[model samples]
Target chain A: MRTLFAAISGGLFGTGLMLSGMTDTRKVQGWLDVFGNWDPTLAFVMGGAILPMAVAWALTRDRSPLLGGSFPAAPDPRLGHNLVVGSVLFGMGWGLVGLCPGPAMASLSYGGPSVWIFTLAMLGGMLLAPGVRTRLDVMASAA
Target chain B: MPMDWIYGLAGGLLIGLAAAVFLLANGRIMGASGIIGGLVDGTGRSNAAERLAFLGGLVGVPMVIALLMGFVPDGAVTANPLLLGAAGLLVGVGTRLANGCTSGHGVCGISRLSLRGIVATCFYIAAGGLTVVLFRHVLGVI
Candidate 1:
């Protein structure tokens, strides 16, 4: 039942990403191109997504989740070095190719060689990150 | 003419609904990077099946939709392979390190009023914005 719900959610999310034109790298790049021909469509997408999610948070604030387990704890707000460095790196990559994991995976059917290569490389990077994170953690504690 | 904003809004709503569903039904945040990362790093071994199920749906549904609708975006195919690979690597590493992405941080986090999510979103977007300026306007490399 849980897995089924997860699949349904993932399917819906992927469909949403496709329908929103987020699969279009050019459009995503255009949105980020503030000084150039800035497209405001992604903003609308973000705004629309936030409304229901906000309501969901409000509705589920006090109760345990409907399916069974306790709701996730609130995210920690500490200013960590990993967070800053990672975000900056991610941003540069996003700028280079407007393919984040969600969109990249969703576009696989049609995305050809470039997408394949990107996905493979992304997985490699993911595989390597744990080691890097451990080192960063050690450095952080030492400082 | 493309109903760009309308599509974006409608799609965004669906995305939110998906997030809400995952949260309500599974008691988990619908973060792609985190979900996939956990699997990769063996951090989510306990919930491996659930994560795979979610991803299967994420990719499977789109495959069917694209097949049925013949919806293929042409612009994505032309990217330089090397750059594409490099970008993917950065995204994978960065999202894991940061612990969220657009869906998790931008939508779920902000909606839940999580300061970490908000801060992460702001910084990544700002960095993304700066990257664009440097690449497109100043360097003209991309």
Candidate 2:
């Protein structure tokens, strides 16, 4: 049943967040401190993640998505100023905040009440995404 | 054993499994960046809904699990709020510009071995490395 799958999936996902230390911004900040004491845990975690991910991608790329049902994979729109600008900003933000979308989503599993603050910021960020994209694109177009 | 480490592993397993299943059933790569990007371009509403659901699961289900398990993170604790806000905004902008994020380029794109994804990933890694160096070494935030 979809209900059973959903419940089970939710549990596993939450558990992963908690185990990965993503819930702790301190750990994240420490990891990002590349030249300063450089916690290497994130490396192992990202490494652990690659295996299953690779399996899934290889198996799934040619078929239709079960939930989305055969949605077409589009060609890359590639190569423009947006790429350069966006990546730079993303890196800057990650360097400063110690959390990005993936880790931020995972941190919610830690369950302290303040996690909500991070969540709100994340949602707010996501919502503002379109507008920001448009502005950047417009800037690119004019430039 | 640190509590957070254990929890993070569990979380990664969950995402991996879900990603696997989504791949099997939907035949879609679970690249949050790409899915989210498509929503912006209006090329994939269906992709958009699934992405929303996936994101919702990423954020909500974790807390729900913690609630049921009776082990909540302390204090709803967070870092510098302004820093997080700025970070999130910048990430949004960056993801838009890159045409994907770690999930898209790092996970899905890498899996496919796409040249573009490789280039994007390289850029992301380089930028992240430089940013870390800049913040800690050049700027001395650390």
Candidate 3:
């Protein structure tokens, strides 16, 4: 039951991404290209997304969600160095290629060479995450 | 160009619905990077079946939709393989390091009114905007 719901949710999310023009790297890039011909499509997408999600958050409060697992606690609010630096790095990459993981993975079937290369490298990077975290931990300890 | 507001809204709604379902039914955040990242880094072993199912649907449904509806992404992608690879590396590493991405932080986090989500979103969007200015406007390399 959990897996079925997960698959359904994933499918809907992918469909939404494709429908919202998010799958197009050009559209995403245009949104980021503020000085250039900025397209406001993404704004609509964001607004549309927030509506129902906001409702869900409100309704789910004070009750156990339908699935059995406990609701995830609110994320830590600390404005730490890792969060800042990591986000900037993510943004730079997003700006450069205009392909985040969601769209990149969704469009993989037809993304050809470029998408394939990006996906492979992205996986390689994920694989290296432990090492990076270990190094960060070491630095913190030394400091 | 007319901003396809209708499509955007419809798509966005569907996305929200999906997130809501994942939250309501599974009690999990629908973060793509986190979902996939956890699988790779071994933090998600307990939920491997669920994660795999979600990914299977994520990748599979899009392919089916593309075939049935003839929908293809309208954006042009980078032609240079090296640049594409580098960008991919950054996104993968950064999302994992930060522990969220557009869907997780931008959608779920913000809806819950989490400060970290809002701040992270602001930082990344600003950084992305600045990068475009540098690369597209100043350098003209992209």
Candidate 4:
């Protein structure tokens, strides 16, 4: 049941990405290109997505998931160096290639070899992040 | 308003609905990076099947749709191997480090008014725009 729901969710998410033109790298870059030919389509997409999710969050406040596990706990409000630095790096990648993780995966079928190369490199980076994070934490503590 | 805006909004709604379903049914945040990243890093070994199932659906559904529709989904990415690889690496490390990406932070976190999410989103978007200025306008590399 959990797996089924997951697949369904994933499918919907992917379909959404394709429909919203997010799977297109140029569109993504257009959106980020504020100075160039700025495309506001992504803004609509973001706003549209937020409305439903905000309602979902509200609904979760008073009840548990229909499934056995608990809903995700509230995120910490504190700002951290990891959050800021990591996001900047992620943004640079997004601006460069116009693909985030979700779109990257969604585009794999039609994205051809370029997508594969990017995905593999991304996986390699993911594998390396933990060690880097640990080192950063150590350095911060020592400082 | 261009038709693309409508498509984008409709698609965004569906994406949100997907996240809602995942949260309500599975009790997990629908974070693409965290889900796949967990598997990559071995932190999600306990629920690897679920993660794979989610990913399979994410990749499979779109492929199947494109096949049936007889139209390719718009997936134009940079052909530059060096740029693609570097971008991929940065996205991978950055998302893992931040513990979220567009879906996780931009959608889910922001919806819930998560401070970390909002802040991260702001930083990333700002950084992305700046990077674009540098790469596209200043350097002419991308």
Candidate 5:
């Protein structure tokens, strides 16, 4: 049952990637074009998604997430160095290869080899998470 | 381009299943980024069942789709492998610093109606948007 639901979610996300042309690195790259020959489609897609989600979050700060979980959903918006640093890292990658997890997984339906490389690297990143967290914790404590 | 509803349904199920299972069994959200980050951040995994299971579906489904549907990726794909790996790593690191991914914050957290989640999601969308502009437009990687 759990697997079923997760599959559905991934399917929806993957489908979105496909429909939006996110699976195509070139499309993503094209959207990345800002000033010259900027394809504003991606911005519109993102904006279309963000507003509703933002409103929902603002309204539901006190409520538990629909899915049962250990932690109550609460606003923990990071406005410090973390946000900028993380965003920069994320943007850097998004700009470079045009495949984030959501889209990368979606692209696999298309079966591109580059997507495979990304998937492996992403898994590697997941694997390295513990040590990084510890280091971050130590640094925060020291600071 | 119109998205196929069949795929949407499938994706939705995967996402929902991952979320429900992770939330119930592991007491975690089934955000791949967060799960991966937790592995890195030195914290004992609060729950791994749903995370692993959901992640598995994420990859497995694509292969299955290709097998079952005879889906072939477009022939024009020519991305640099090294760059792709770098992007993945950056995303992982970003998840670590942000404490959640788009799935976690954008979908689950926002659904729960948290302000911070909203902020996080905003940052995510904004970064992603600006990134397209900068790399694709300003720098022109190719």
Candidate 6:
């Protein structure tokens, strides 16, 4: 049942990515290209997504999930180095490729070898990140 | 008033609704990187099946849609292999290090008013814009 729900959600999410033009690298880069031809469609996508999500959070506030597990607790509010630095790096990559995780997955069917290369590289990075993060944490503590 | 914006908005709503369902049904955040990352990194062995299921749907449903609709979604990924590899590595490491991606932080976190989510979103967007300015405008390498 849990798995089924997850699959349903993932399907919906992918469909949304396709319809929103997120699957298009050109469109995504255009949005980020503030100095060049800027595209504002993504702004609407962001805004539209936030509306229902805000309400979902509200609904979840007092109610438990239908499934057995508990809702995720509030995240730590501190602006940690991991959050900032990782995001900056992620952003740079996003700018370079105009493909974030969700759209990257959505595009796999027709995205060809380039998509495969990017996905494999991204997976390799994911595999390496934990070690790098641990090293960074140690460095931070030592300094 | 462009059709693309309308499509974007409608798609955004669907994405939000997907998040809501995931939250309401499973009580978990629907973060793509986190889900896939956990699987690759071996930290999420307990819920591996669940993760794979989500991923399967994420990958599968679109194929079905494209087949039935007869329109392939264009990703327009860069043909440059080096750029693609570099970007992929950065995205992979960065998302794992940060513990979320655009879906997790941008939509779900911001909607919930989580400070981490908001901060992450701001920094990433700023960084992405700067990269575009540097690479596309100044360097023109990518």
Give me the displacement of residue B64 in model 4, in angstroms: 0.5
DockQ of 2: 0.42
lDDT for each of the candidates?
A: 0.86, 0.61, 0.86, 0.91, 0.58, 0.90
- Candidate 1 residue-wise lDDT at A26: 77
TM-score of chain A of 3: 0.92
Better of 2 and 6 by TM-score: 6
Candidate 6 error regions (>4 Å): B72-75
Instruction: Write out the backbone clash pairs for model 3.
Output: none
Instruction: Name the regions of candidate 3 deviating beyond 4 angstroms.
Output: A140-143, B71-75
TM-score against native, each model? 0.96, 0.76, 0.96, 0.97, 0.69, 0.97
Off by over 4 Å in 2: A1-11, A66-68, A71-77, A109-115, A138-143, B1-14, B33-49, B68-78, B136-142
**Per-residue alpha-carbon lDDT of model 1 for B1-142, expressed as tens digits?**
2699999999999989999999988999999888888988899999998999999988999999989988655755546878888888999888888888888888999998898788888888888888888888999977
State the lDDT of candidate 1 residue by residue for A40-88, as single tens digits: 8889888988998988888777898878989998778686888887887
Per-residue alpha-carbon lDDT of candidate 3 for residues B69-128, written as tens digits (9 for 90 to 100): 875544388888877988988888888888888898888888898888888899889988
Question: What does the lDDT read for residue B29 in candidate 6?
Answer: 92
Model 5, C-alpha of A69: deviation from truth (Å): 5.3
Q: Write the per-residue lDDT of candidate 4 for residues A1-143, one digit (tens) a residue.
A: 99999999999999999999898888889989989999999998999899999999999987999878788988998888788888999999888988899999997888778888889989998999998889878877888
- The deviation in Å at residue B88 for candidate 5 is 1.9
CAPRI-wise, candidate 2 is acceptable
Interface RMSD (one decimal) of model 4: 1.2
Could you tell me how far off, in angstroms, the CA of residue B119 lies in candidate 6 after the best superposition?
0.7
True contacts kept of 5: 0.33
What pairs collide in candidate 4? none
Cα misplacement distance, residue A101 of candidate 5 (Å): 1.5
True contacts kept of each: 0.80, 0.45, 0.76, 0.87, 0.33, 0.86
DockQ of each: 0.79, 0.42, 0.75, 0.82, 0.31, 0.82
Q: Would you give the TM-score of chain B in model 5?
A: 0.75
Residue B42 alpha-carbon offset, candidate 3, angstroms: 0.8
